[model samples]
Target: MIHLEFNSESENEGIARVLAATYMMKFDPTMEEMADVKTAVSEAVTNCIVHGYEDDQGKIFMDISNEGSVLKIVIEDFGVGIPDVKQAMEPMYTTKPDEERTGMGFSFMEAFMDKIEVSSESGKGTRVIMEKKVTGK
Candidate 1:
């Protein structure tokens, strides 16, 4: 397992994705698997920055681990938590309409990862857990 903590900034999203990819290298994931994990990580980190922090800077935590063929990733933030997780996961439902946000972050994550679980509170925080099986290994 590996733990990462970074500031909830737009630039850090790339870093998070790269870190996830690098960590998965040991599993020898295929191009598709690598892309899927990177994209999912990007979406999770971006959510922490745009929705969780909401223009404010906060800490985002990520934990990655693997067992056999399954890779698990957890991204969390202690900023303003989600008020309605179900509604937020709905396609095309974005809180920032003015920003032209597509609201497809969660959808993409779900499509790419084998399983995803999200938990959040009104003020405590939000946590997104994603898991995928690397068949190429």
Candidate 2:
């Protein structure tokens, strides 16, 4: 298990992705699998910086753990939480329409990970939990 907390900066998103990929090394996943995990991690962290904190300098927490062949990742932010989590996860649903946001963060996470669970409360925060099973490990 590993835990990471970093400022909600765009550069930190890459850091988070690298750290996640490093942690996943123990699972002995292939290049494609690692790439998938990195992409999902990037999206989750980017969401925290872009939407959660709105680039106002907040904190993002990440937790990673592996059990058997399954790897669990949890990304959390304490910024303004989503008012409608279900609506937020819907494809092409972005609050920042003028910013050219594709609103595909959650969609990408869902596509790469075996499972994705999101929880949030208005004015509280948001949590994104994802799990992937590494085969042939």
Candidate 3:
């Protein structure tokens, strides 16, 4: 198990990218798979920075590990949680249209990863768990 904590910011995403990069080489994943991992992590961390904490100072807990044959990532944030997860997951569903949010974050995770799970409560917090198989090509 590898543990890393990052601030919810764009600059901090580089750390995430680095982690993904190192993990990819360890697992010998394909370039395409590595790209998916980076993109998915960016989306997850971006959500933590933007909607999770409302662009405020917050900590993003990044849990990365190999689960036998699977690569797992769990990102947890202690910030405003989603009230309507169903609506949020819908394509082009933006709570802040004026902010120009594409509402594609969750969808991208779903598309890029094999399994995705989200749990949140209003005024409590949110946690996103994603898993994908890593196969050398």
Candidate 4:
């Protein structure tokens, strides 16, 4: 398993994403798959700060592991959680478009990961878990 933690801040999100992709490489993902995963992972971290944290001070946790044919990634943040998950996951949906959010973060995650599960409580925090099959090249 690989673990990562970063300040739930924007400037630091890129570094956290780089670490996530680097660690995920241990699974021997294909070059094309790696690019997709890297983009998805970076988007996830950005969501933790821009959406989950609302650009406030917070913490983000990432856990990566593999079990048999499944590759799992868990991204947890201690920040404002989504009150309505259904709405949050919708394409082109964003709470802060004024902040320049593409509103495609969750959509990208859904597209990249084979499956995604999310749990969040308003005022508590948010956790996003994604799983994919690893067919190494």
- Give per-residue CA lDDT, model 3, range 72-97, as digits (tens): 99888889999988888888887878
| Full candidate order by TM-score, most accurate first | 1, 2, 3, 4
- Superposition error at 75 for model 2 (Å): 0.3
Lowest-scoring 10 consecutive residues by lDDT in candidate 3? 17-26
What's model 2's overall lDDT?
0.91
The segments of candidate 4 whose C-alpha lies over 4 angstroms from its true place after superposition are none
Candidate 3 Cα outliers beyond 4 Å, as residue runs:
none
C-alpha local distance difference test of each model: 0.93, 0.91, 0.86, 0.82
lDDT tens readout by residue for model 2, 59-103: 899999988979999999999999999999999899998996998
Error of 1 at 29 (Å): 0.9
Between the candidate structures 3 and 4, which one is better when assessed by lDDT? 3
Q: Between the candidate structures 1 and 3, which one is better when assessed by lDDT?
A: 1
Q: Worst ten-residue run, lDDT, model 2?
A: 128-137
Instruction: Quote the positional error of residue 21 for candidate 1 in Å.
Output: 0.5
Give the distance in Å from residue 125's predicted Cα in candidate 3 to where it truly belongs: 1.1
Error of 1 at 128 (Å): 0.1
Candidate 1, after superposition: displacement of residue 23 in Å?
1.0
TM-score per model over all chains: 0.97, 0.96, 0.94, 0.90
Q: What is residue 83's positional error in candidate 3, in angstroms?
A: 0.6
